[model samples]
Target: MSTPAPPFSGFPAGALSFYAELEEHNSRDWWLAHKDAYERDVHEPMLALLDGLEDEFGEARMFRPNRDVRFSADKSPYKTHQGALVGSGTVLGYYVQVSADGLRAGGGFRAASSAQTARFRAAVDAPASGLALEQVLQSLRRGRFEVLGERVKTAPRGYAADHPRIETLRHKELMVVRDFGAPDWLSTRRALTKVRDTWRSVRPLVEWLSQHVDSDAATT
Candidate 1:
């Protein structure tokens, strides 16, 4: 029988260095030459990390290293960073990425359709659910998690510029992120603890979306 993959022991320092070099030499030849290091330092570590996290976070997905350049102006052949999603399937959930910058973890709906956006806005407009969401955002902010999302300068079509929950309503795609760039603990088992804590903190936000937004759309 095949041996089970070992538990995550944190990412190696080389993972950061590899990405730092990739940022400068984002070419096919550079990538091909250093592919072994990518596997040893970056890819494998991520897989192990995800495996360690699966128990608490459920199945996770490792994104491809290749960037989709078909419709983009900046056609970089390869992505500068590696990323993954946890507890996600057809719906949005948690995300983590590592690069020269180090680690980033957060959660939200990324590609909410117009219908979904309408539903999200509706939930935010209601006093009970909207207030609950605001509380969650405030708590995350208190914990220093950065709230990020695409938004309009003014209010969305139906919501007033003066609306109380306009900021939340204006979000086309909402996510919260914590960026820990090259911390000393990054290359140790502490990385696993840190990531788990962060994801747990993000759970309420994810649950809010699931309960107030995704659940209905899922069945339809």
Candidate 2:
């Protein structure tokens, strides 16, 4: 039999401090100087956390520490934070990000493709699914999750300006986020508990998106 993964003891104290300093000195020279700290404090703990989560949440993928500055004016060489996507893909998954500010957990579709956007609107325009989505959002809000998205200033072109669900109709990309915000629990095993619970609370949003927005429309 295989050995069970060790319990996540939590991120080292240096993890936050390293990112704190990285934000101030986000350059290759500084990163090369502190490569060991990055590994010992930041990278390793992330791997452990992901390992602990994998059995129940599926596989996880970590974002590179290197910044993709190809199209950006800000030429910083390293990220001020670390983030990962949990689960298989954008269809239905979770996201976690840690930075100097603290940890955040999220789920749901960040942006819908054109076909997905069409399906999403169609479902929202349908009373039953629209009410179902609203109930899910309400439940998340009560659990302290924030619902956000890129949205048009007014209703989309085809939707009426005064439509009952016009506000939701304006969203171009829909997602949910929960920020732990520098809590003391962040340095304890409870951090994993917190993240797990947050993901649970947001799962309904992921399900809604999969059923109403993506599933069939995604293939075409």
Candidate 3:
């Protein structure tokens, strides 16, 4: 097996502007020319952030870069940017996708799928695990959160008007969300504080997600 990378310390400032310029010239050739900069500026910093979180929370998995293009035509090899943080419970971590236009965030202890949702629901619903469920639900109820995305006036074309996920999300708003939670009040406070201290490192990337085009409408 490949050795896992270490947790990240934080993101680099100006990473968002670098990505924005690259997106303006979106092309395989451009990516090849500028991929190194992305690694140095964006990816590496994100890796540091993830590594830092991992030191405190355990390993965090990264999403694959390959877009599932069977449902769409706009296939770009690399994402504009990335972000993530630790969550409470066995889930351990959450991911954020930062592009030019918006950001969205979600997580489950189980794999990310319908089956995982079902499993999460079951876990939360377990009578014997009421305390555990209460911990998760309580964190969600805190509500001081951020969604990264642009302000849109209408729904984008090619998606069904009533698609469940689309209907649930506000139109013209695309954001990568990072839900925060902890095992206890002290831990929660620390997590949020650390996130705040590092906010400048990741905020630009999150802002970028709201400004760029989302290529995963069908799957999103």
Candidate 4:
């Protein structure tokens, strides 16, 4: 049996301002100076959010705040946001992030490995599976979720440029996003509820991708 999630009050006070200030002063010095506020206003509330989500969404993993700067010219010392994943293993599962902009949530594999991509294209080209995927994309659009991915200008080699499913075939990765504009509710428990509802709405698409495009899908 699953344990009940703990009651959560809301994001800690000044969570938004902390991110905003971090954006302006994105340095180790600035973060060290205000680390206490980060703990109280940002990290703690993120933990509460994850705790509240774990029961229904599975284990939630918070990302590190440090930015990987080894290969990038823009070397900001920290991320401008906090992101977490609910679920385990290689599946992309439910994700939620809070930034100075607002909260964003939803799920899907952002990119498929070459082997997975071949399988995904096979399914996308097949009549039955292709139709099913189209319907899923349509449903997501109707629900105000933005379907996103890196796309090639032309259809992949085997598919015709003008093929009925060509637009989808051009995609190298796929995911959905639901932006919950920063509102008063973001500072309350309602934010958790909002994220839960959006995740639920997109769960089918997540499942479909796991079943069709994940590495294990090839075996099945």
Index of the highest-lDDT prediction: 1
Per-model TM-score on C-alpha atoms:
0.94, 0.87, 0.50, 0.89
Q: Which scores better on TM-score, 1 or 3?
A: 1
lDDT of 3 at 210: 21
What are the per-residue Cα lDDT tens digits for candidate 3 across 70-106? 6677766555655443442223234544444333344
1 or 4, greater by lDDT: 1
Model 2: runs farther than 4 Å from truth?
1-6, 88-92, 215-220
Lowest lDDT 10-residue stretch of candidate 1? 211-220
By lDDT, the better pick of 2 and 4 is 4
- Arranged by TM-score with the best first, the candidates are 1, 4, 2, 3
lDDT of candidate 2 over 59-148, digit per residue (tens): 887878898888899999888988887743534468888888888898876553677677888888899999899899888888888878
Off by over 4 Å in 3: 1-10, 83-92, 96-113, 124-135, 146-193, 196-220
**Greater-TM-score candidate between 1 and 4:** 1
For all candidates in order, the CA lDDT equals 0.85, 0.79, 0.43, 0.81
lDDT tens digits, residues 32-103, model 4? 999998888788888888788778878877878898888899999999998886653434677888888888
Q: Which is better, 3 or 4, measured by TM-score?
A: 4
Looking at model 2, the pairs that clash are none
Residue 36 displacement (Å), model 3: 1.7
As a whole number from 0 to 100, the lDDT of residue 192 in candidate 1 is 84
